[model samples]
Target: MGILVQEDKGLFHLQSAGMSYILQLVNDYPAHVYWGKKLRSGSNLEGLLNLGGNRGLDRLPQEYPQYGTGDFRTPAYQVRLEDGTRITELKYSGYRVVEGKPSLPGLPSVYVESAQEAQTLELTLKDDYAKLSVILRYTVFEHTNVITRSVEFTNAGETQLRLQRALSASVDFSSGDMDMIYLAGAWSREGNLTRRRLVQGGTTIGSRRGMSSHQLNPFAALVKPETDENHGEAYGFSLVYSGGFEAEAEVDSFGMTRFTMGLNSFDFAWLLEPGEQFQTPEVVMVYSSEGIGEMSRTYHRLYRTRLCRGLYRDKERPILVNNWEATYFNFDADKLESIAAEGAKLGIELFVLDDGWFGKRDADNSSLGDWVEDLRKLPGGLSDVAQRVNNLGLQFGLWFEPEMISPDSELYRKHPDWCLHVPGRRRSEARWQLVLDYTREDVRQYIYESLSRIFSTVPISYVKWDMNRCLTEIGSAELPSERQGETAHRYVLGLYELLERITSEFPHILFESCCSGGGRFDPGMLHYMPQTWTSDDTDAVERLKIQYGTSLVYPVSSIGAHVSAVPNHQVGRITPLSFRGDVAMSGNFGYELDLTKFTDEEKELVKEQVANYKQIRSLVQQGNLYRLQSPFEGNETAWMFVSDDQREALVYYFRVMAVPHPPRRSLKLNGLNPELDYILEASGEVYGGDRLMQAGLALPDIQQDFVSGCYKLKVQE
Candidate 1:
């Protein structure tokens, strides 16, 4: 069933894949009744409400929790009027069902390639008191257990409407027992999975750092108290936004749970003039009755195919070698060519030159805005180096922090007003660089053209778009004083516009977004760029947790994992070369090291890693992943990936720190056909799929810290 509307009972039931969501109108107000397994047709709605021995205001599920309904729970969506009023009420007005999904203007959203691929439900709720209207839009894909939700506000009344808090979607559950799972960390240690019980009262996670921040990601999962990778019910919400966002999970006094998500309310105020409308970003909702594993796979399939678009979306990315930790800012043409020559000999496909390419920029403190090449470093110019790398049989890639400007740069010297700064206040600087006020048309055009000029000079195949700092003096000269609150949101809009124009123009270029490495790794950025640098910490042991935590929601194809030199650049924890290579292979494999200095043995190992990865790139990038053992629970972590057709599988096992006479732990594999027989590539041993999954494969003995093993299993024909 797609979307069924019962006009007689004033109910809307949406069914997609194997799940169903039910919404009904009670006294003209929209209320959510059931959102779980597919229900039988003509099921009694009253029985699903679970009113707790009451049938009035206290028990009704408030779809848009309002102050006038005696629902003390936080209102789902909020706004204010120019007449100084925040007391608002919304009642269901009308709704319509459409064929295909509609794109959010100037925003990154999932698109339906065909009318038969998806169906949409647009429900209109009008606030008669403020003469404002709210459109609740939901799109259900025919073949995916995913329902995308967004809100649109239109000023239909006589006066201007100011929106202080307009959340995208909200759902209420009569049960209070659930566990909240989220990813939280800082800088190089991003995407650390954290789980806690959803107790009484409210728990909110968000980012006010302007660029989704490094502190918290814009996704959260609520599951049954006993939920795990293999069992129990789970509900996940991921906001399709790159900028600041807010997710609130609150439990009311009656032990009911409510989850709401949207743009962060802090420094966010939108003024909607009469006859104008504003659309909030989309929040993807997924339900899984089997467990969190099924929920994650649904997200992976939806985002990898629908959300991430471009030349690299379905194609396997070329193995790259980046010169960041290798030379930092102290590399010249000769030095870069030496590294590229070694990489080419080792089968690396791309070479990326990072930073210090232009304008007296030997360090991070200067030349951020100067896109021109420094003759002293390049001798002839960047074109010479690009051509040289091309002759070495490697595609050339370059890094640019185009959103920032140094105070001593030529561009900043000419246009001091271009940076974001409050009129009379001192501008705060991070990394000795100031953020550009992208809200200004002049600033956006200048930066866009500057980048275009660089791409025109060389046959660059990739660009690492990096933003090294956050917004400090968050003010824009283009916006008036009264509308300064709109700067943050408008800045995000400007960024999207710039990205859209550039990505569309240079469709051949492979763009990888890195905000201090994984800071801005959200769905919105993935919508423009296919992959993001997972993190800056290349330590093999640390990456075990980072990659595992990131894989909770994001697919392996969208993560940028690299093998860096040791003693590790970030943590000083040097491990075995093979261990590092194994961890990096879990994502878009690459190397971040000075290959020219590698020992003969290490060079051979690098070549072997590259060769091995190519043989199984598609299996790792486009396979069904199963998280076997959690690193959060023990010293050992294990994961496996089965090819889509179930003909092959790869299993990875890692031991962070070895213990004396440790207990043996068996990893039960998932996503395999029990009736098939499989052969071990390394051992020439054959076993039935059912035996491999039920009896399980025992881990090899762990002899040292930071050690790992990889197993390849093939179905016996």
Candidate 2:
């Protein structure tokens, strides 16, 4: 259970029963080539702080050249351990270059980058040795979840070194069974308004391959750079930054997987002459039972369970209907109030005024962060509309993109340098807009102050925090030379910190993340928001694919779905109102369509659907889910749910295509109390469970239907 020591390498960890892991570390790495620590670990790890195991290296000098810090205080190397229950690792972050220490040419003779220096003061420098690149002490808590690893690279000596940064980790994936050979791909893209991409199966969906690495299990790494000649090599997604760095991420991996995250983009060498400070990219791996969606859900749980226990978990989510797909940058406040009045009549929760509320946001090209109410459209201040809705028994919600500014807006004119732009370099204008850098505390403060004023003044129940673009041409002319690449990493961290502060101060207001639909749909955002808009696509048919893919990991409660009108604004496909209600039932359900346009009967249907949702919210939100047939399988897909008590179950079978002829009997169900009598109440039609569930029983089967009417099963004890 403990580490043993030797003279050369500081420590050797021994595996023990139920021990879960063996991590050997040599704290002082003589050199500073950060990208390839794994290949260099066995030779460079030289510092010593062993837990209980023997030091594997030949004993070296206390201030030996072998055990020393490099130019930047980045994490040296790492070993990851995980079971279904727990994931843990030992790693280090902060490293400062000290003067007069052991120097390596222009590098420091000896350096110190301890876990304590990084402000993770809770960690103990349990073990270290001279092995690979500089290996050393780290906290066991770092790898406990989806957080990967973080290394702070401080310029210790007086001279700046070439910053060719690439961050990676090593994992011993000794699986008890055959390792699930998964093809590594990234749905990730930088936040640049000018660029957008999707990569699946290690190949970019529409363009050339983005960054991804090929793993040889705990060993070789074949990097598929953006400039790689071979376009089809199966590899893990790797993003290389040849310039200034910035960005924060929570990584997750399976079997011998290293969720390597880093910020590159630093084309020029950092000019850290002396007394200059900087930090390497931070990588944290979060754990989730499912995949990407759960990866995001875990972040939310961490915020709730770990960080903000005092913060009440918001139970009453805002029931705001968006006007994006309903009216799409059209309609005035009077028109909005008419719709809000109708929503209030249905016990509809909140009335939200979506986009087109601000300056020239009409066609998605301008008015991103122009918070002023569009007088041309609204004819009245936004608060007038909010007050009107509040009086009508509905809470009001507003949309804002404070992190972005359009060229057509007043904010961009005053502070043109506020964005992440470099002088003389062409900047990307995604959707004809740019992301305002929040890396600067001033920018962060501006957003905080502006939104706080609006929210505090009004009875706003929710705010849709939307990020419509990704980063391209990332460079902050505001930062110093050594810390320039820091914009990306720092920007992301700044965002997290900003959200933390804002949410902490205003705990009652709900924030829903809207990243150009679902682009920012990850654990990172969930840490700040109660729910995310499932996708920008309000089309019910497209939503099925988007929501189905989203649900593989995330709880249905975290997904935000709406019943929008068809010729679905995104994908022109009109579906039944009943079907829309059924699909939206799984998540935080609401409707986005203009209710004023619906008939009296349809309004009554909305009322009925709302009531039905409340009755089964417990079942749909907190039940064991099973996919009897995959949506990707065939013309029809079936899914079932059983409550924790095992008494009630609901099955949904949808046939996308009509069958020429249908069978007379329904398919037999499973996971029921086999010996108990049952009853089926489907669409208010009741049938005895024992008779309906009997094998070969002749029962009425609706010829393959897409209407997700429930087939309820109640089992008697």
**Ten residues in a row with the worst lDDT in model 2?**
208-217
Q: Residue-wise lDDT of candidate 2 within 1-717, one digit each (tens)?
A: 222223344333221211112233345322111221112224433332222454222221121121123211122222111111111122332232222112122110011233321112111221122111222222222222322233333334433333344342322211212112112222221111111121211211111111111101011122222312122111222111111222211111211112223443334233333344334433333333233322333333333333222232435344466766667787888888888888888878787788788776778877666676778887767778888988898888888877787887788888888788888988789788887887788888888887888877878878888776776666776787556755665566677668878877887778887766655554445546757776666665555555655554345556788898866766577787888877777667888878988989899999888877777766665565554444544565555667656688877655555566665636555445555565565544444445444561233455544555557677644
Q: Write the per-residue lDDT of candidate 1 for residues 23-63, one digit (tens) a residue.
A: 88878878888888888668786456655565666567776
lDDT of each: 0.89, 0.50
State in Å the error of residue 223, model 2: 22
Q: How close is candidate 2 to the true structure, as a TM-score?
A: 0.67
Following a full C-alpha superposition, what root-mean-square deviation does model 1 have from the true structure? 1.3
TM-score of each: 0.98, 0.67
Stretches of candidate 2 above 4 Å error?
A: 1-169, 174-316, 622-624, 640-650, 662-700, 712-717
**Once superposed on the true structure, which residue ranges of model 1 sit more than 4 Å away at CA?**
50-58, 663-665
Alpha-carbon RMSD of each model = 1.3, 11.6
Give the distance in Å from residue 58's predicted Cα in candidate 2 to where it truly belongs: 20
Lowest summed lDDT across 10 adjacent residues in model 1 is found at: 45-54
TM-score of 1: 0.98
Identify the leading candidate in terms of lDDT: 1
